[model samples]
Target: MNKRKIIDRTLLTDLAKDVGLNASHLEALGESCQWEIGVDGDMLERLVEIQHQFERLAVMGDDEYRGFYIEVPRPAPEEWGDAEELIASGEYDSREAFLADWLAFNPMETRWFHVASNRYGDSRSIRVTDRKHTHFIITNHSKCTDAEPDDTWCRENLTRLFDYLQRMIDVIVANPDGFNDYVAHNLPYQQRTGRIAQKEFNRIVPNCKIEVEDKETAIKALEDSVHGRSVPPLETMTIRQYCSYYRIANEAYEAYYRKRGASGRFYEDPQDVPEELRDVAYYKRIKFVDEEILYDIDSPEDFIRFATDHYGELGLSRLNIFASNKRQKGWMIIVSNSYSANVGLAIEVATALYKARAPLLIYDAEKLLRILLEEDYVRLVPDSYHNYMGYQEEGSVYELPWEYECSEDTDSVLNKEQYQAIISNAEWQPEEQAKPIA
Candidate 1:
């Protein structure tokens, strides 16, 4: 890079000599610097496009979003007609005077969108994710841990979607030029591997050395990182892996109660979701207007709130469902509340009774346990992104696994207020109405 010629040569020479910087790294670093400086041909073209976008937006006035991103690493103040000579000559003495001039001259500073223009799709939000933003996070248990679950509900409308996915991945594999640019843009501000494409990024970029304690080890690791070519947290998923992802999202939409609503962000219009899969809202709504539905329970707390409101009582206990030979031994769940509650649970020994359809969530309860209960069971590293204290399974979280055990007296787990309240009442309405078992 031309910048390297003027940078501290002695320091560069020492680092290169010490680490034995290879030719590939040298070239990569040079290209990275060039991108930062706005020299790359594609980047230059993009800059022009961005400027045109700004001009077009400015002409539209306040009817729509008239504001635009002032390009990253904005041009010098002089470029915006702010002459520094005025300040140097004392023409602008106080901070107030300088800011007044800036606000009057800097279009980027003065520009803003109308309040009505703040609606969704009016302006783009910067997001860094590997998968398409659309997702169905929950699913039935079978699809949760299963890598390749059978596709049972391939509705005709979804054909366009699958075809689009196939075409998109084909482009990524054939030439990841756009993908590389996106990763490079967020490389500095994101994790060591950038926001997404993290595993794919590992193949080239060097690991960060900021937190390494041992000086020698840090240098050696950085040197090896750039030079050594290998895989590293999650490699780019193969077609099988991508299919499993599709399976989970797809099944979540179809499994269980087959409720009418969908993700709120895109619910406004099915047409907006280009390659239409299914009319998430319109299809099944009028089907069961009279049925008692678990309308909007998005989380455990929401479930607790609904149960408490409807049943007038809550309790807790254990339920273990055993499996056949060569299978997982059993699955255990914390269940129940105090006996007198009117709420009906489906299983015997459960509280709370519902006559109508209640939707089931497609979820990996095992993985979800690890995420939600991490404070209780997962050990923390003092200064790390991950909770595990050490590499692999060597940590307190793994060593002392936690499972909820019903109290001998109350048949409930304790600590949190909700859990505490569930067990406070010892009396229950009896198993017939209680619908509970351990």
Candidate 2:
């Protein structure tokens, strides 16, 4: 039997990291893309209506088109029990009679109707349903043109729709923990394993409506096994506790591996590995496990040699360079991502601002851009304070891009006078402006 390897969640996270995109954002993008390709269940119905309208216009004002005319019909509201009784009692034998009675007391616009045709020398008809009740222009039409709708227009509309959906998905993914808590108990029996934990189980199944009143009893029955007080000496506790213990054991194993220093790189033979850390295909399975990165490189002597050869002095220099250019000066503060020194590029760029004498005010660039600017030796301050604590009051301190979070901090700074000057002196040059994407 061929055993399929499961990639753990860590590996997936690592893959996301490697691609420089968040999983939530990726999911949003994927959904949006799928929607663009017409994964919607109702899309075919919509397309059918559109095509039917074209068919209805083919042959008009002919005797054969008598029953093909559009008819507006309405059904009684569900709240009308009396109407339901009459409808069941056959008080109104035909649809028209029922509709006439329906319209007498409660009048409403009919949004859907059918346009059919029998002039094709055979019976041909179409039923059109309006998805949106937009105002329709009734007019005479020539033959149905075979030309398709504009591709660019369709693409633009689809793109806009997808983008809106993606934004909503991003917001949802960012707060997974909160959403999970809301669905914990009411989930169905079949979907119990769908969630990461009980809290998450409750969240996604919020409307499942299953009662879970005696949760404590189940927990107590499994408690003896969880705390290792069960009767079976060899059997151990319940599955949930077993999972908890497995998590703890993995943590301990990782801690142990990390404590062994660079020498520990040689501990795991390339051919042999702990079961938990064996898989490399999964991000969770291989991340920080050390064995994957340093596996098979031979003894400590060989491992040390490899490290020195590949990442020793140059790596140290890179680390030093990263550390030195990391911190960015906010108007009244300094900030840096302590774990990763990705701001080195920004420091270099910020240095240019300093050289240009673009004011000591913070340039609201991204961390990297700020670091690049700082390489130019620009002095920026946090808006909250004056002077780097020297207590000098500056008039109307502007927030720089460094302080503001943006995927790319490229927004240029302009004083009130400068902005006014541009507005006053600017000329209309439509030709020079780039046309927006449709």
TM per model? 0.18, 0.16
Q: How does model 2 fare in lDDT?
A: 0.28
In candidate 1, what are the lDDT values of residues 130-161, reduced to their tens digit? Answer: 12111121111112243211332211112222
Residues 1-438 of candidate 2: C-alpha lDDT, one tens digit per residue:
212223233432333333333322222322332222331224334433333433322233463332111212222343223655676798866555765765664443221222222334422332221211111211112122422223454434323323332332232234323322322322111111111222222232232112222333323322322343322221212222222222332332334335435233222322454544433212223223343354443333333333322121111212111111113221111111211221232232223222322222222233222222222111212132222212221111122222112232235343344333322332211111111112
Residue 260, model 1: Cα distance from true site in angstroms: 27
The Cα RMSD in angstroms, rounded to one decimal, for candidate 1 relative to the true structure is 27.7
> How good is model 1 by TM-score?
0.18
Model 2 deviation from native, Cα RMSD in Å? 28.6
**Cα deviation of 139 in candidate 1 (Å)?**
39
CA-only RMSD, every prediction: 27.7, 28.6
Candidate 1, residue 87: how far the Cα is off, in Å = 13
Off by over 4 Å in 2: 1-35, 38-341, 344-438
